[model samples]
Target: MSQHQILNPADHAQLRIHTEAGAEFGDNVMASLAMPAEFREVQAHYPIVFRRDAETGKLAALALFGFEAGENLFLNGSTWEARYRPMAHAVQPFLIGRAAEEGAPPQVHVDMGHARVSATGEGMRVFDDTGTATPYLEAVANMLGDLDYSWHESDAFFTALETYELVEPFSLEVTLDNGSVQTLVGFQTIHEERLSALDGDALAALMAEGHLARIYMVLASLAQFGGLVARKNRRIALG
Candidate 1:
């Protein structure tokens, strides 16, 4: 039911985007895609993990928000209780698109059916009365550009991880204060043992390509799981 179209000032002049954080805008998710460039910021708030595409067998990074599907521990009513949100979630309702012609520049595409897309003049405007892009739109465009570039960078980072054999399956079992247990499965994390086993040359290669810091960031992010669990327990206690 998504209505996607190339964004234009004339067609979407009156369009406004709801900027609030809430589940009604599809923010109730357990995880969001993470990129290497943003791993530092993401690691401070969420645990970074990897998931493989079943069809393509491609590995992609994810920032965990909760232990279960559609349950975002960061979401507290209309507010997201985090200092940063992943670009995958922040960009909502907007995406980069390409034209049919070869070598065409990327274009901004909007999902008209998205919950954030509104025409009631109740949200941030996409365009001004003079048919020019608004500040909000400009900021979104910059974010889209960063997301597009980081997406390709993530591919290289994953490829490097595979080459170094640094990835391994990970699982966790969390027991709440109320004695309920939740098990997280089907995610992957860096193999510290293998990573330590690598020779100096391999380590240099990773560092040269800027993947070493990100790898450590991912490792550091695992500690955030305790904070996530605390949030979950607090939510449970409140209810």
Candidate 2:
């Protein structure tokens, strides 16, 4: 039987956001997008939530979906003892600990206090009093669907990707200046592996001899060489 190729958008969405910049996107959104999917399956059960600022009434940040487990309550990492709390806050009670004392809470807050890049080519760095540092700027230029050299014009995008590792099907929901959220999906590939396979001692010499092109080209070439894998229910086959 010939192998059948199946493209599942959900599978690519479930990757972890270990990077500080990525965590700002929120757990609910990431989990919803990242969970692996079977053919003909519906969307994820949980809804991506955005937190509102008490003072401003604006959608300030995202949520990590911390809920009470029982007599013993559980947040993301820290554990809390359950108590008789008000009905309104019973589901996600506020913990009284170092994180709460610092007013950071269990959720990853984004906006003025986190990494931000301006459309006008300006950048800023933000730090919380609790020693959390965020570098604000367009660190990378990510092109989805197909690889193109035209994106190399942007300084921040170019500089960031120059030495960065490529992770496939990168999903991100960016909050725009007007408080609108935009979702981006993309892929990544690295040059280190390809360069290491070559017989070279000098790193500079490798680049001078067109190593970058070879790396990126190899990634695309995988499609031609049947490196792409097709998956269906109970089966994974080469495409």
Candidate 3:
């Protein structure tokens, strides 16, 4: 029942950022550039700044570091790409203003794109395809024919969403299961989006009734259960 703490202001400053940690895929670790002081009175939020190889200091991802105008801001590393550069420029001013307030320098920043590095020394790879990326709970529900196994009923599947009151935005798709000949897209929550959706009202309500801890617990549980399994790339040897 522990409460979530907004990362402290000081901790953000001290982190050294890096895109490639080593030869291993997941070995690429990110850290602070040089910890900053607790100067800003406001709760400052800044995009992750990566340390560049050419220079010893931190470098901002190009997708997030400059100004263009009238565009969407790319926040997650997954969404950063050539297609998103224009959007990043649109919000450049706002980002710069925030960065200035935090006394953070800017470098070329970009989104990490939709990819995850395996802990093993494998190369970069996509985590999931559109057909099957739903969270485990939702996947199970869909695979087993709705949360209550009432797929035969008209509204059983849709009712699950209403019942869970999914507070977060998640991707769902219907696809074929290897053993079963059915296609289904199960529900999966987007962590960053869900966190962003928390408003002052929600926060106050959660904290007031000890439900805040429960919410976090549920999220953690979901994360552990909800992961996309990449079946294609996996190699299975049959004797």
Candidate 4:
């Protein structure tokens, strides 16, 4: 469970954010819900796929990092292997929170129990001694704000995919070095066949909505699965 508290310099003047790679943050499975907005950045390194939320059963986009649950193959010591980290995962321990005043506006909140929080001098400072936000803190605020806005756009993007019936189940079968076969399920991907068959008007509409490129990006990201499988194999070899 998360203990989210509305971030305030008064209550968190001494808070410090972790500056090292996010690999130590104990987040193996990262949800890639920032499609359309973050598709290009995420696609450059991670395999963009789709999954449904266990609690809400809501379909969402995701960037795969491991073959199994609770495993992050990109975790190379304290640093993640990817050149570009998903914005959804890059900003850790902070999230959009409901404002204390009713209907005022959403505010940024920090997880009190997050391992990244510390009172020490190392890492980025959340606030100055006089209880003012530092540059790093300001950047985090901007990121959170941007994410809040982009998430709405991403929602519409996914809705368009659903409307066009482009969502389809995807399965991957990989053979490990020891000749053991593994089947991955419970995931989905964009239907390229349907996309390729769309009429010019529909394709133009998708282009107008800025979703066509992202849909193609999602399709292209599947190629990274070969890398993911190799990574999983490397981990197994290490063991």
Leading candidate by lDDT: 1
The list of candidate 2 runs beyond 4 A from truth reads: 1-128, 131-216, 223-227, 232-239
- lDDT of each model, Cα atoms only? 0.94, 0.25, 0.27, 0.81
> Model 2, 1-239: lDDT tens per residue?
22221212232122111222222222111211111111011111112222323586422111112221121111222322122211112211111122445655332222221122123333232332343433311121111101122222222322333434222222445443445444533323344454455445545553564444433443443332111111111121211
TM-score of each: 0.98, 0.17, 0.21, 0.92
Q: What's the count of clashing pairs in each model shown?
A: 0, 7, 34, 0
Question: For residues 196-223, could you state the per-residue lDDT of candidate 3 as single tens digits?
Answer: 5667986675467544443344344332
Please give the lDDT score at residue 143 for candidate 2: 15
Tens-digit lDDT string for candidate 4 (17-106): 886765456556634454568888888878888887789866788888777777778887787788877767777788988756878888
Extract clashing residue pairs from model 2: 13-33, 13-34, 14-34, 141-157, 166-188, 166-189, 167-188
Output the better candidate (2/4) by lDDT. 4
Task: Tell me the TM-score of model 1.
Answer: 0.98
For candidate 1, give the lDDT: 0.94
lDDT of model 3, residue 75: 25
Rank order by TM-score, top first?
Answer: 1, 4, 3, 2
**Which of candidates 1 and 3 is the stronger one according to TM-score?**
1
